[model samples]
Target: MNTQPLDDAGGPTAGELGEHAVIEAIVAAAPSSSNGDDAAVLTHAAPNSQVVATTDMLVEGRHFRRDWSTPEEVGKKAIVQNFADIEAMGARAVAALLAVSVPAETPVSFFERLAAGIESRVAEYSAELVGGDVVSGDQLVISVTAIGSLGGNLPSLRLDRARVGQRVVAHGKIGWSAAGMALLERFGRENVPEDLTEVVAAHCAPYLTPGRGVVARATGATSMTDSSDGLVVDLTTIAARSGVSVDLFAEAIAPGPELVRAGEVLGVDPWQWVLTGGEDHTLVATTANDVPSGFREIGRVGKQSGDPAVTVDGAAPHYHGGWVSF
Candidate 1:
């Protein structure tokens, strides 16, 4: 990989580098022993263990904007989202495959930075970037397939496993990404408040504690999901699938001080982001046993009554919005 500075303006383009050189750069940026073959050959799973896999895609302009985020941040966000799905299933990520599509004129430096970003995040989770593909297209497109291991004797955490009387628990922030996105959209990146820069970073590349899903599973989590589509929407999915209804506590899940300050600046209710905003990748689970360490009790599951599958303070939420891929 080129170590010198090469901004988009005067850098060598993918078209100029040719496919072979571009792929070699990417592999050099993120090398793995599992690479160099036609396909990645993963190790055998542990005794009585199962393999878990999930895929997610990000398209330039639709999922992200170059003006708002760096190529590195885009790579990290793409990897994080896919790995979060793996963890949500009560598994530990073991390997990942990345596929990228970009215009022929795209800068080679962009991919180098992107590969570094993906490799860094994958390393943080102790997962391997086994193999991937690069292709030419009109716009940048990134797709990741994360492979995980549900270690011996543990059942895969499924959305429909929640039962009536289980306590709903959550780990990690719920609305920081949305708040950051709001800050960026309303104030632009350069003008964001100093105190709110962290929020902006969260929107760019959300982070979650790795292996929390296994912790939740060991702690008797019955159902689990990541807050990729907002708290209410995800819980609603759990409820509908599990034949139960969820009633969240307002105070338990309310926005914190930073969010409150952001709300004041934006004149938008912070609770709206807490309930309706998405992509924080927070872990939410239902457990009949004690709430696991690093997790807080936020709500409880009940027999499905009708109409609203999820509610806060036993009432329907005023903010019904959440990310809809459509």
Candidate 2:
């Protein structure tokens, strides 16, 4: 059994210090007992139902900006958002592995805090780090692969099931992060509020957690997913996947005062923020009439035809949903 840290033995810290070198470093950090094995071996259980799995990545300067977020916050955000994905499938996150790529000149302090931040949420969610890799790269990028169990139930996959006459609902609030981003644009990192600013941070430093919204699941839901993309796109995904049309109410939007102020400052419509603004990672779901206890009955999912597609108040959306990569 050869036990060593990631930086040694020709890993990131001692390697040629390139992108591949960094990836090798982070990969080497995974604690594989097998000296020459490529993957890990986990304890298996007799097949009863099924295990749901998902993988996601967060890159600096693209997915996140270090100039706006602390390494610790970045670490937690990476873990929580992925966990949110697992929860959207109505599952419980159990463990995760992380791979980090940083410049060779990067201080060890950043790594220390980064690991601490990730570990804090992993522990908070009762997940273990298991193993990971560290390497040198052009910029800091964090890649995480999380594993979860379906709590003795079948995973509620995105493409699993869909039917007409389902109700569309979202847990938690909306437009907060969009409002937060507006604050950042206006305040220039100066006038950030104690509460509202976090939405921006949550967008950048998102804690798409699980425990906060679990109470709504056990009762019932037709289908569900995280609002990572925005209300329109996310609901569109549900409608498109479930093969149904979704209708929403614009005035039904319960805008918080923060978004109102954000709209005022940005000279935009707050209603637009609720429908289109994404990155909040709030829970959005469809139910067959019997909505969950904690979940709000927002709109109904049905056949989309004639006139407006995904109407709010029986009319088409005035604005498109959120931003995009391309």
TM-scores vs. true structure, each candidate: 0.95, 0.80
Q: Mind giving the per-residue lDDT tens digits that candidate 2 earns over 26-110?
A: 3343223422345555546435645656777887666665555566777777787787787787777776777777767555555
Predicted structure with the largest lDDT when compared to the true one: 1
Clashing pairs in 2: 22-135, 22-136, 25-134, 26-133, 26-134, 27-133, 30-132, 248-312
Which candidate leads in TM-score?
1
What residue runs in model 2 are displaced by over 4 Å at the alpha carbon? 1-49, 153-155, 193-195, 208-217, 306-308
- Which residue ranges in model 1 land beyond 4 Å of their true spot? 1-9
TM-score of 1: 0.95
